[model samples]
Target: MPNATATPPAFRYQGWSLFSLLAALVLLMTVMILIINPDLTEGVRSAIRATARSSFVLFLLAFTASAFAVLVPSPLSKSLVRERRFIGLAFAFSHLIHAVLIYWYGQLNTEFWPGRTALGNVPGTVGYVFVLLLALTSFKSTTRLIGATAWKRLHTTGMWVLAAIFAYSNFKRIPMSDWYVLPFGLICAATAIRLMGKLAQANKRQSLQRVA
Candidate 1:
């Protein structure tokens, strides 16, 4: 039996605690958006874009945290590893806000939406599908339902697919402004970092086995 005197795991690690905080953060941002803007439609669009940026950044952070912890010798990276699930859920929450605003956009002016053809929906739809799958399987029980090996395959494929979507989305908009370069560069850098970290961790593990 577990020790009765031991403290429970931090809320970030145990069940829905971290998700609740993420929901609150998204909600507060939403409320502030409404309060601050005189033009609600513009505000909603701005909020959508803001949430888009937040979700992308969160996704990058979540995707890299574990390998980063393995590669780096730092308390911060290790903390990020511990909070990986929380960070992922936070990314989902941010995207949930993004989805809400998108729906609102469609309701207010659906013509602003892309044509119903798969062309316009290609990457966006793909990203959402993976996010939903990832979020659902994020639970230990749900992950077990698919078996660990299959779950690993799905997540690995999904993460790469999502990363490509993010990179493509930003790169395609280069005509808008030079400012887009920064985010595109950041995503590319993060991807490279994750790959390098994984290789380093793999080499370390092999070395340990050899030593043992």
Candidate 2:
């Protein structure tokens, strides 16, 4: 008998896969940015000192944009969600950079990256831990081993962790007037709304069944 299960085309190593293309573009962009700017190092660089903070701020903005881009409801939204695993991995790498920048800032200012106290490290550490877990479980092997139900549960938890870290990071980086924050915050709200709508629809269907 022939094998019953068919592999998803998305999982196959297609030539020029979206994940590969995005990864290449990001790598090229980073190289270009460094070459154009020079002195991209974290220390002993005047340009670094001038732009480091805003770079992180802008990173947060871009991160939020990428997340919203995936969530935006449209024709491509389903494909975006289908490819979320890859997109999420990319987001995790960006978050990792943001994490390093925070640690580096702590080293530089002696009071900024993490505050002056031991407690200051808590939030940054929490953020790092979240990103680390995200990175580790993001592997396709790990997802396959965990099975879909388990993986979905894990992803739900990851989402909450992600939301928490986003809030913590933004709160720590407050006093900036970035209009993007409103939309970023809305992404979380939208998730909640979507879930509630799903539940309502399910409940409505059940009530009709009972009446029939």
What is the alpha-carbon lDDT of model 2 when measured against the actual structure? 0.53
lDDT of each: 0.82, 0.53
* Model 1 spans > 4 angstroms off: 1-15, 114-117
TM-score (C-alpha, index-matched) for candidate 2: 0.59
> For every model shown, what is its TM-score relative to the native structure?
0.88, 0.59
Top candidate on TM-score is: 1
User: For residues 1-212, could you state the per-residue lDDT of candidate 1 as single tens digits?
Assistant: 99986444433443367667766877788879877989888888888878888888888888888778777757667667677777888888899889989899778766767546768787999899999999999888998899999989988898898889889988988789887788899889989999998899889899999999
Candidate 2 segments whose C-alpha is farther than 4 A from its true place:
1-16, 36-74, 99-116, 178-180, 192-212
Error of 1 at 40 (Å): 1.7
Query: In candidate 1, how many Å is residue 146 off?
Result: 0.9
Q: TM-score of the candidate numbered 1?
A: 0.88
lDDT of 2 by residue, 1-212 (tens): 75666333433433237556655555555445556764545432333322333333333332343244334534344344456666666556555444554455556566553435777667657756766776688787987887889877766676666565556555544456575476456545655654564566577689999999
